[model samples]
Target: MSQWMTLFQKEVLEMWRNFKWIWVPLTFILLGVSEPLTSYYLPQIMKSVGGLPEGAIFEIPKPTAGAVLASGLSQYSTIGALVIVLGTMGIIAGERKSGVAAMILVKPVSYFSFITSKWAGSLLLVWISLFIGYISTWYYTGQLFDWVPIGEFFQSFVLYGLWLTVILTVTVFFSAALLSPGMAGFISLALALIISILSGALSNLLEWSPSQLTSYAGVLLTGGELPSDTMPAILIALLLIVILLWLSVFLFKKKELAA
Candidate 1:
């Protein structure tokens, strides 16, 4: 336990040193604030751009707060997810490349503790950053649009966070399994895209998949009928996270032995 804590602290400090704490939150905050501001200002923005013919009566309906928040989640689904994958792609792979993993493993540290500490640290940063960004978006949303119910807002946050967790776990697993950080990130991103595409194309078959979390989140925000498969999707996402973490540890040890 002590060893895990120490390693976790090291990971946090490393993130701090690398400015993950700064930029990740800042990026999310920007994305969050932009969604509400843009939605509110779309009419004026369109008029300024003058894309329409002269005297064209272009107007946009005011978006509800729930819709605004749901759109913000979509922004996170693309740019935010990319940021997370790029930021964390090197977590384990970089350590191994720089000989840090070898040094740490040569000590009494168990592989479980080492890998779990890294995973926990990375997740802590991600969740905190997402919370900060999402809260900023929520605040602006209430100001520029109708207030989203607090209960539904929080539920959406947790569901979207779960989606991100599955994506991040895939990145971590690849980082552990591969020597090249670029390859790890590429494969992770590709896998995420594949999962998303398949989930959408076969929604009936994949109702329990993690990718459904985003849609479920949108439903929560919009106050729509909750999907009956929501709990199953959540459970499957959690299960995928666990399975990936286990694979990370196993692959990390095997790679180290091969080295």
Candidate 2:
């Protein structure tokens, strides 16, 4: 337990050294704030561009606070996910490549402690960043539009946070299992895309998949009736996270053995 805490502290310091603690949260805050700002000022922006014909009546219906917040979540689904992948793709793979992993493992550290520490550290950073960004978006949404109910907003946050957890776990698994950071990132992104596509194409079949978490979040935000499978989807996502972490530990051990 002490070793894990030490390693986890190391991970945090590394993130700080890399400026992740600065840029990641800032990037999320910007991404979150952009949606409400754009939605509110889009007409003025259009008029400034002067692209429309003379006397053209360009009318965009004002979105509800829930819709605005949901749009912000959609941004996270794409750009936010990409940022997370890029940030974490090298956590284990880079350590191995640079001989850092072997150096650490050669000491009194157990493999489980090593892997779990990294996982916990990375998850903490990602979740904190997401929380900052989402809260900023929610604040702006309330200011520029109607206030989203606190209960519904909280529910959506949890659901989207779960989807992000799944993505981060997949990235960590590949980072531990693969030799190349680029390959790990590529495969992780590809898998996320495929899951999302599958979820959309076969909604009924994959109602329990982690990919459906984002959709369920959107429903919560918009005050729509959640599907009967919401609980199942949450359970499946948690299960997937556990399995991936376990695989990550196993693969990390194997990789070290082969070295």
lDDT agreement with native, every candidate: 0.91, 0.91
Residue 168, model 1: Cα distance from true site in angstroms: 1.0
Model 2 scores worst on lDDT over the 10 consecutive residues at 219-228
The pairs that clash in candidate 2 are: none
lDDT (tens digit, per residue) of candidate 1 on 1-259: 8999999999999999999999999999999899999999999998888878877798798888889999998888899899999998999999899999999999999999999899899899889999999998999999988788888878888999999989899999999999899999999998998999999899999999899999889987887557899999999899999999999999899888887
As a whole number from 0 to 100, the lDDT of residue 118 in candidate 1 is 90
